[model samples]
Target: MLQVEHLHKSFADFKAVAGADLTVRQGDLVAVIGPNGAGKTTLFNLITGHLTPDRGRILFKDVDVTGLPAHEICRKGIARSFQIANIFPRLSVFRNVQVSVLSQKKLSHTLFRPAQTLVVEETNRILDSVGLSDKKLDIAGSLSHGDKRVLEIAIALGNEPELLILDEPTAGMSPDETTTTMDLVKRLATEQGLTILFCEHDMDVVFNVATSIMVMQHGQTIIQGRPQEVRQNVTVQEAYLGGA
Candidate 1:
């Protein structure tokens, strides 16, 4: 569903992503794993239009979308969740999701209508999918960290994206919460048929859930293969395991 060809991005003298090429097929759960400064997030920024690539092409479906604006890319059916919780702190969970739903529909100007009443059913469905239905009326800032992350996922879901780009979805959660988040992501791909491309530091999470894994080091992909194949790769072992 997504194709990145010979992608390169640089900041000043430093190259962050160097000729990175990747393809994510429909309904595939692909994980990009790398250490700090490996350029995983930079690749994501390039694809999502947060940063223009110094070189290369980004194709979604079959159309080239190299330098499209973030919102335009999102409208083209790609949605991203940040490593941090990017929630509207003061907005109720329902309203937060409602805003996304409105944004997706280009109805942001419908301010006079009650957002809750306008998108209540769809918002509730998203909340249930993310296991946050009971917290629909709660303030976003007041939820626990794990719930906040789930809220971020819910917000991403609001766009009904064909491809979801998640940066560190299980970043700071406890063991149980991480497991729950992993389960949610698996269901997103398996049941909902959403294509997932994520960057994660948690090896166990990557190994357990990823259909394929790409290992990056020094701003380049060192290995791309199935979980077991990547696990046994010599360079991966030398760079990630030996270092760990």
Candidate 2:
């Protein structure tokens, strides 16, 4: 559960997030949708503490986390994936998730500890969850773009986050790959009850997978409603859906 009130962020003369307000309740798979330069990614950055807001407040699980560092946000049960893949290229797929697991346990300094095989089972389980069990031995850089995205999600899930924020989870995938990845996301939200807040440009993905939708424009929230409500909203249609 998260609540953001009148969040404002700016860079010199340009405002990236201007008085944006959002509330993500438990069990809500919320879609953040807007055109390019609508501050969607900037909003996520603000929420995750990658960029501190100039004003307003961010409350995660009823605790004010405004301006907390990125690591602190992750430790507090919020994990995120980026628009671009972020993974260890040379590490094996299994090792990628293992690194996150070790980091979660504060044991990243113990890398290459053959005597301490502590995260093997957890890493295997995480790889299996992401459908990468077969490729666990392969180098992460060798994976397809879609598998890489799945791996990123696995890494984010390594710490068992309560709220997962995905920024453009299907940015560069083939149609089939996009379906597979988004289906995986949907299953996590529906079957595993993982709360998700995703920013997506794909209208089909947004309408099909999200329970609720938030439309942003000019660095502000313009619409927040159920899927159907967002679909038919006149303002959203004029400002966002129409262009998309």
Candidate 3:
């Protein structure tokens, strides 16, 4: 559960997030949608501690977390994947996930015992959930773009997140790959009871997977509602959704 109240952030006269507020309840698969320069990513940065808000508050589970460091927020059960695939290029898929698992446990790999061996089963389970089990031994950099994205998600799941923030999860992918990724995300929300908040440009993905949608424009959240409501709203249509 997360609550953002009157959040604002700016960079030298350009307001990236202007008085935005929203609440994400447990088990929500919420989508944040908007056009370019809409401040979607900036809002995520504020919540995740990449950028401290200039004003307002970000609360998770009744505790105020505004201005907490990114690592601290992550340890508090928030995890994210970036717009670009953030993977360890040289690490094997299994090892990449093992790093996250070990990081979550506050242990670093040393020559004495490889972290991968210690968390092999759990790491493999994450890989399997993301449908990358077969690529476990493959180098992360060598995988296709879609697979790389999946790997990044596997790493996020390693943190055992209560809320997963995915920035452009399907930014570049074939339709099939996109569908696979959406299905995997939906399954995680359903089976694992994970809460999700994602910023996405793909309307199809947004409409299909999101239980609720928030439309942002000019650095502010202008509309927040269910999929059908967002689709038919005249203001949202003109502002962002491009409805007919």
Best by lDDT: 3
Model 1 poorest 10 in a row by lDDT = 108-117
What would the per-residue lDDT of candidate 1 be over residues 1-244, giving only the tens digit for each residue? 8888888898999999997878899988999998899999999988888999989999999999999999899999999999878999999988888789878876655465665466777888898998998989999999999989989999999998999999999899999999999999999998899999999998889999999898888778787889989888888898896733
TM match of model 2 to true structure: 0.95
Candidate 3 or 2, higher TM-score: 3
Q: Give the Cα-based TM-score of candidate 1 against the true structure.
A: 0.95
Deviation from native of the Cα of residue 130 in model 2, angstroms: 1.0
What is the lDDT, from 0 to 100, of the residue 173 in candidate 3?
Answer: 90
lDDT value for model 3? 0.91
Better of 1 and 2 by lDDT: 2
Candidate 3 lands at a TM-score of: 0.96
Per-prediction TM-score, please?
Answer: 0.95, 0.95, 0.96
Error of 3 at 172 (Å): 0.9
Clashes of each: 0, 0, 0
Task: Give per-residue CA lDDT, model 2, range 105-190, as digits (tens).
Answer: 77755567652476888888878877999999999999999999999999998877889999999999999999999999998888
Two-way lDDT contest, 1 vs 3, winner: 3
Clashing pairs in 1: none
Off by over 4 Å in 1: 108-118
